[model samples]
Target chain A: MQVRKIMCACGSGLGSSLMVEMNIQDVLKKMGVEGVEVVHSTTSDVHPGAADLFVVGRDLADFIKDVDKDEIIVLQNIVDKGELEEKLRAKLEA
Target chain B: MAGMAEMLKRENVQIVEGVDSWEESVRVAVQPLVDQGYVEARYIDGIISNAKEFGPYFVICPDLALLHARPDQGVLKRQLAVTVLRRPVRFKEEGPDVRVLVTLAATDADGHIEVMRRLATMFCDPDNITKIAEANTADEVYAFFTAPIE
Candidate 1:
């Protein structure tokens, strides 16, 4: 499947977003998933058409109410590395 | 670059390994410098404490080589001293080798630049990271770190 884009959101748009973006790229590469573009953004900057799926930190979960729940994936903690890959892969496939 | 290996050879540096938790990781990373008496033990604790209170920031993933930090604290800032990338720049599961992300945040951008340059010069040696990861004993790691850099 072709993953055109994936948007990662964090509170500051500096730390967490960068971390998630890097991880996503790694996960995609490992899964042999390609054709995806990853971008980082703050909660305020997120808008439709910016990307297909939005990955967010647990703290910022409430901020993405307007976004469809299916399109939004929230992390309760950062330790779920395996779960992240599975969730993202499922999203990209769908 | 002086590299961590050369730094290990210096009289004032030390290195420790197998640190799994965030607090233990900082303690191990900074303990060598403290043993050589370059930095006071109390000071090292302060940094670890601050990082703990402010952190839970980054988590080393199960792949053993990858790291992920809280998105909120993505851009790490440190006021002084040597810095190691707290977050990994990239991840590859097949290779056991781990890449740590580090940044030095100073009072100003210029300070950050200067410190980064010094660190880059100090840790740029090809075998530096290999030596650090392969080290078996704290003293061995310390010796590798304090060694003079060319």
Candidate 2:
């Protein structure tokens, strides 16, 4: 599956999600991946076709459980680049 | 939008002994912003209500929480507050205990990205959180927050 866009979301769409978005960009850069557009918004934006993938912290995982499991990355630690890189790599490879 | 350093002034950063509960912590963390008219009093309620519904997702990393609510909920301006709890507070029984509550009052979704980026840089190093939490004075905490990011 080709991934082009990813959305990181949280309850307020202000803080945590934005932090995750930066982390996603960092991981993508480190992996030498390009052309993946990343954005952050409220959890309300997590819907089918909203984006190729949705990223959120584990606390908000239930909000996006309805989305395809393959398209959602629920981070146990939003600040951990290692976890994000591993999960992003798996999803990109799969 | 003010940069994170400008938004977090020395007066906005504080070190308190402790609070009775997470709710109180939010209230206390947000109190300075409220007093300065950066946000309305309801903003505190907004953060607490959002927490009640979504759990403490703002506890973005261990021992740290970035407190905020929907901009429309009550934000009057863009600002940041750092409240260091000498005694940590836990938002949930299983959640990490938080010692630093960084209150974020953004006027819109995108205005605070730069500030959040600075915070992301600081939080990426967990020791920064510990350092801020252990700061002896508000001036020290303010310096840690406003210091240029490498």
The clash count of every prediction, one per candidate, is 24, 0
CAPRI-style quality class for the chain A–B interface of candidate 2: high
Task: Give i-RMS (Å) per prediction.
Answer: 8.6, 0.8
TM, every model: 0.45, 0.97
- Whole-model alpha-carbon lDDT for candidate 1: 0.48
The C-alpha lDDT values of all candidates are 0.48, 0.91
- What RMSD does each model have against the real structure? 10.1, 1.0
Tens-digit lDDT track of model 1 for A1-94: 3458888875435445555666677688998977889887667667776777888866567677677687787765433556678888788777
**Lowest-sum lDDT 10-residue window in model 1 chain B:** B62-71
- lDDT by residue (B1-150, candidate 2, tens digit) is 668667887888899999999999999999999999999999999999999999899998899999999989999989999999999999999868999999999888888888888888888888988999898999999888887866
Worst 10 residues of 1 chain A by lDDT: A10-19
Residue B66's lDDT within candidate 1 is: 16
- What TM-score does model 1 achieve against the real structure? 0.45
Specify the highest-lDDT model's number: 2
